[model samples]
Target chain A: MSPDEVHYPGAVPPARTRFVRSLGLRLHVCEWGDPDGEPVLLTHGFYDHARSFDLLAPLLAERYRVVAMDARGHGDSDRPDAYAWFPGLIDVVNMLRDLGRPAHVVGHSWGGGQATDAATLHPGSVRKLVNMDGFGPPEEGFHVPGRDRDERPAPGQLAGWLDWRVANHSRETFRPCATLEELAERRRQQNPRLSSEWLRYFAAHGSYHTPEGWVWKVDPMAARNIGPFRPEWIAPGWARLRAPMLALVGSEPDTWGPLPEPMLARRLSHVPKVERGVIPGAGHFMHIEQPEAVARIVLDWLEAG
Target chain B: MTRLRDGRAELALHELGSGAGPTLLCLHALYGAGSDFRDLAAAWPGRVLALDFPGHGHSPRSFGGSYTPENLVANADVALAHASEAQLVGAGLGAYVALLLAGARPDRIGGALLLPGRGLAGGGAEPKRAEPEGMSHARFDVLLQGITADADPDPMLENCDRDIRPPDYARAHADSARLLLLAEDDAERPPWWHAVREADCAEVAPADPEAALARLAAS
Candidate 1:
C-alpha cells in the first residue's frame, strides 16, 4: 500500500513539480509539455488533486503548456487551519499572477466555481475559461444557508450539521482502506464510470499509505465547505465574466454533477460568450472517463479563438 | 448563567440582571463574543442573557465548523431555549441571525433590536473575506474593536456573502416589534431600508439598547 510500491501502468507523471506561496501556504504545482508554450492551468474538483489532471493535461499540453495545482488542503499543498468556499478564488487569482501573464484556465467541479469567480473578479488574468460541470446543485436543490425553506427546515438541518461537526472535527481522519486496491475500489463506488486502472492511478496519487492502511490526503474539514452560497449568486459573476468560456457536462448521469439541461441552459445564459457541449457516454468525471473525447472538445474550444 | 451542554456542543450564556420581564437575549456582532456585551448586560434592567454564539467565546466551533447563518441561527436557537420568552438584541452578524429567528420563532422572540450589521440590506457583489493571516490588527479593530483578539475571518466572510439579507424580512417585521437601527454614518444603506413601506426601523447614532429594550418592555 505504500506509495513507493504502488504503481499504475500507463499513468504519466508531470514534467516538473514545484510549489508556490499562496495565503501563507505552499501550494504544489505540476507542469507538463513545453514550459514556453502558452499556459493552460488545470484546477481539480473537490477532494481531488493536480494529479487528477494527468489524462487531460497531457492532451492539452500537446498544444499548450499545461500547469495543474493541488488546491490548498488537497494533494501535497499545505493544509490550513480551516477551509472556506471562496479562498479557492483567491488562490486561482494568485496562480494567474504567478503565471506573469494571462492563461487559459480549466477547472472541474468546485475548481470550476473557483475558476469562474477568479475570471470574473480578475478578468485580465484569464484569456479563456473552461468549466467542467461545476455548476453547483440544481436550483431546486439549492439551500441558502440561513434561509430555510419549507422542505428543509433550519432546525433539523442545523442539528444534523452540528452533529456532523461533533463527530468529524478538523483532526478527524478518513477511515483507511486495507489495501491500495481496496482504496481504488472505494473510489470506484463513487466514480463508477472511471476505468479500474484509472481509479487505481487516482487512488495512488490522491491518498497516502500508512501503517494502518491507505487514507485520502484531502482534509476531513473540507466536507460541507459550502457556506451561504446560492445558485443565483453565480449568475451575476458569469454576467460579468470577460473571458470566452466553454461549458461542458457529461451526457450520462453521474454522482457528481451536470444539473438538469434547462437549468444548465439558464445558468449558461448569463455568460456573454459561451460555447456549451456534452461529452458522449461520459459521466461527472467526463475527462477521466473519456479523455480523448473530452480533450478533443477542450482543445478545439481553446484554439477556436 | 452557566454553559449549557446540548449533548453536541456547550452553549455559553453570559447572564446578568434578574427579575421580571422577558430576558434581554443579547447576541454579539460577527467579530464579537457574548462577553462583548458585559457593559450592556450590566446596565440593562431585568434579566439579560447574552449568548456566545457557537465558535465564539467559550463555545466550541460550530457543527461542521461552519459559521454560516444557518449554523449561527441554529446555535442561537439553542440559547433561546434558556429563557421562557425573550427579546433579541443583535449587532451585525448577530442582528442578521436575530431577524431570521424573529420570523422563524415568533412566539419565542418578543421583539428584536437589530443594530447596524452586514448584508442586512442585501444585493451587492459577493463580499470577499479578508484572510486571517493577511488582516492587520488595526483592520480587525476597525471591524469589531478587537473584541476578540483572535477573531477568525473565515466565519465573518462566510456570513457576509451576497445572500446575507434576511429572506423573510417582511415576515420578521410582520409586527411593529422589530427595529432595524443603522449607524448614522453608514454610507451603504441596505435596499430594504428604503423599500420598507411601514416598518418600525430607525437610522440614528447607534440607538441605545436599554431604551429600545425599555420601550419594548413598556409595551
Candidate 2:
C-alpha cells in the first residue's frame, strides 16, 4: 500500500524489511516465527504479494519458520511482465538452491502448482509439499498452446491504470505493511491480495491523478490477445517432483468441477506421493474463505511428519 | 378485472433441446445477456437456458427496482423457471446474481461458474475501489465511458443508481473474489515469498465465461 493509505477493519502500521539474493530477480520476503524453528515457507498465488498471508503466517510461525514470498508480476518482485511460465519456476528453484536446505513448501492455486513443480524443477530444494488448491493437473497446454503469445492486458488500459498508480502511490506501494499485526488485518480483508492492490496500483500506475481522483495507469488502448495454451506436452517437465504433496481444493470448483480426470492423472503420474482433499464450505477462494480449515489442514500435515 | 396487475409483466420465453444431459443456465456480465455464455454451452452437457438480463437485450424494462442485485436475481429467478434444473453459469454482473441466487436458493442452482465478477463490495454509491484521491471521479467517468462507449449506459446506469458508474457501461467491481483470490494464493506451504504483500488494489477480472458458466451444464 502507498504510505498514508488508511484502510478498513482498522489501520495497520508497516514493517521493517530484509531480502535475499539469487536467481535473476530479487526475492522480497517477510518472516515470522522463530528463525531457529523449522523453516516453513509460504508462497502466494498469482498477482498476490506475500504480506496478504500475514494473518495465517504467524499462526503457523509460532511453531515453525514462516517465510512468505510474492510471485513475479505481483507484489514487490521484479515485474518481468514478460509472457513466460515454468521459466519463473526455475528462478524460484535457483533461489531455493541458495537457501542451501530443502524447504518444506506450500502453495495455493498457482503457487501450489509452482511449489509442486519447484520440487521437481530443482529436486534438491524441496522436501515436503502442501500443494493446496494448486495441485490440480496442469492445464492441457499448461503454458498455453501457442509459445509466441501476446495476451498481455491492454497496454493502453494497463498504462492508464499505471498512470493512476504512479500518481497516487509514492514509494510505499513497495513498502511492506507497517507491522505484522496490521499486515495480518489487511490480509484478512484483502484475500487473493492483488485485486485490491492492483485496482489502486492500476489507478495509481494506470492513470494520472489530477485534482479529483485517479485514472487508468495504462493507455487503455494497450492491445491484448487470448490463447489456447497446451500443458500436456510439458507434462514430462513436472515428472521429477520429489515433494510429498497434498492437493487442497475448494468444496465447490468453478466449472472444472471435481478434479478433472486428466488433471488428477497428471498430478499423480509423476509425483506418486500426492494427497488430495478439500476444505469444507470453501469455494475457489478456500484459504481466504476458510483459512482456519486450511491452516488446520496444513498444521496437521506438518505434525504428521 | 382480468388481474392485469398480478402478472409480473409479459415475458417472452424459449427452451431449446430435449435431450437428456446436464442443464446449464448462463447469465451475462454487466451489459451482457445470457446468450454471451452460449459458446460454453456447446462443450457442456445437457440443455442451456440463456436469457437477457432485465434491462439489456430483449429483456423487459427495469420495473420498480432496476439494476441492483435484487433485481438481477429476480430476473434470473423468472428465467430459471423455464427449466427443471440447471447448473448456473454467470459472468460479470450475471455472476454476482448467480452467487446471490446460489446462496439464496442453492437447490435451484446445481453449481455456479461465477466468472471474474463483482462481489458484495463492488461499484456503487461509494467507490469500493480506492483511487488516487483527486482523479477518481474523472477516472471513473472515463471508465464509464470505456464501458458504455462500447455498449449502452443510459439504461445500464439508469437502472442502477451509482455515481461512480455512468449507468452506461460495466465496471469490474467485487470485494470477496479479490480477497478470496489473495487468500487462495497464500495457502502455499513451508512458505515465504519475496514479492509485495498486502497491496491495496481494487480492480478484479471478469469471471471465466465458459470455464465457470459452461461447466455448470456440462457436469
Candidate 3:
C-alpha cells in the first residue's frame, strides 16, 4: 500500500495491485486508487517503469483508475528471454481490455507507439491518446527525411557509438544520490553531452549503492535493441495507427533528439484527425525529466475534449 | 546467469565469475530490485551473484503474501543454489538478510559483512502511533544540505520510501535474536562476531576494531 511497494523504474513510487496485466504471462501491472473510477492506461518509456508516472498518477488516480503496466521484459514483468513486436502490441491491447472497462491510452516511447497501435487496431478500446515523444515510421524508404542536411550519421548507426557511449557515459550515467535535492543539484552538473532536460530523466530513473555510487537500472541491452529494428517492420505498423496523437519532442537535440519536427509531421500526417505538433522542453523520456510538464500536457489534452 | 526457479515464486538469482575466488551472493534492500547491489558486488574483486528477493526485483510478486523475514530467507536459499559456498556481503538494509543467511546457516558463508545495519529483529515494529510526521521543509532543506560523501545520507536515508524501511529493519532484528546469527554493532564490536562466536565457537577476538576482528576471524 505504501509508495515503496511497486519499485518500477525511475522516481515514481512503486506500483501496487493484484493483477496489472495477464497476457498468459503473469503480467505485473500497477493500478492506483479505486476500481470503479474512470480508467486510464499509462504506458511508460522503454527501460522506465510504471512509477515514472508517479507525480501525475497519484493526482489522476485520485479520480481515475490510473493503471501503469511494466511492459514485458522491462520492469517486474517476466523477461521470458524472448521478444516479438506485434504480439507484444496485442498483449497490451488485451491487457487493457482485461481492465474490465475502457480506458484512455497514454503511452511513452514503445508504450506510446503501442498505445497508438492499440487505438488504431482497436479504435473503440481507447478514449484519449497522449503520445509523448513517440512519432515513428520514418516517412518511407528507411530515410529519416532531411537528416542528411545535418550530416549526422544514419538514424540507426549505433554500433560505433555504443562503446564510445558506455565508456564515457558510464561515469556520467545518471545516479542521483538518495538525496533528492542533492540529486537535483547533481542535475545542474549533468554532463554537457546530455541535454539538461534529459539529465532529469537520469535523476528520476537512477538507483544507489551504499558504498560505490548511483546505478542506472536500465539493462545495457535496452538502447542497443533498437539498432536491429528494420525499417520495413517499423513503417507497416504506422499504417495501422490513426488515434488522435500528441507529438512531444524534448528541447535538447544532442540528447532528447526526436524525429525532426518536419519528419514527425511527415510521418504523422496520415492520422487524418491529428491534434499535432510538439510540446516544449521535453526529451525522449519526458515524464521523469519533467513530470509536471508532461503531466500538464496530458491533462490539458484530456480536458480539451 | 539469473534464473527464476520454476514453481518457486520470486525466487531468482544471477551468478557471475567463478574459479578460486569465493562467490558472493547479494540481496538488495526492500523496495529495491536485486540489481541494486551491483555496485556493492563491484567493490569486491572476487566472483559474485546478486539475487532479486521474491517480489522486489526480478522475482514474482508476493500477491497478498508478505515479504517477511522467513520468506526472504527462503527466497535467499532458493536463489543461492548456485553458490553452495561463498563469502556473503550485504549493504545498508540488505545486510539484515545476509545476517540471517550467515547466522541461520553458517556453513554456507565463508565470511559476512553488514554495513550501516541495525539489528534485523529489534525493538519490535515501531508501534503504529509512534511514527514521526512529515519533515518540516526547513528541516528537510537542512537535511538535504547535510548529505556528504563519507557520511552519505542518500542510500541510508533513501534506503527506500520510509514505510518499507522499518519492516525491513524488523526483519534484520529477527536475525539478531538468533545468537549464532548475530554480530557486533558498536564501533567497538568485532567485525565477524557470528563467525568467531557462533561458527568456530571460540573466544577469538575482542570487539575493539578491525585488526582485532581480522585476527579474531583468523583464529
Clashes of each: 2, 132, 19
Arrange candidates, best TM-score first: 1, 3, 2
In terms of DockQ, which candidate is strongest?
A: 1
Q: In candidate 2, what are the lDDT values of residues A122-204, reduced to their tens digit?
A: 55567788866665434532332224333432222223333343243222232244443434344334343323532332222
lDDT of 1 by residue, A1-305 (tens): 44545455535689999998665567899999999999999999988999888888888888999999999878998765456564566678778878888999999988998898778867778899999998877766644344454454443343455446545653535889988789889777767778788888888888886678788888775655423445665665577788999999999987677787888888888788998889999988987877889889998888784
Model 2 stretches astray by more than 4 angstroms = A1-16, A81-83, A136-229, A234-237, A255-258, B1-219
- Candidate 1 local lDDT, residue A190: 69
| CAPRI class of candidate 1 | incorrect
TM-scores for the candidates: 0.72, 0.42, 0.44
Worst lDDT 10-window in candidate 3 chain A: A150-159
Fraction of native contacts under 8 Å reproduced by each candidate:
0.02, 0.00, 0.00
B-chain TM-scores per prediction: 0.69, 0.56, 0.55
- Give candidate 1 misplaced runs (Cα > 4 Å): A81-83, A142-151, A209-212, A226-228, B1-26, B30-36, B44-88, B98-113, B117-119, B122-163, B169-208, B211-219
Chain A TM-scores, per candidate, are: 0.91, 0.66, 0.67
Indicate whether candidate 2 or candidate 3 has the larger TM-score.
3
DockQ (0 to 1) for model 1: 0.11
* Of 2 and 3, the candidate ranking higher by lDDT: 3
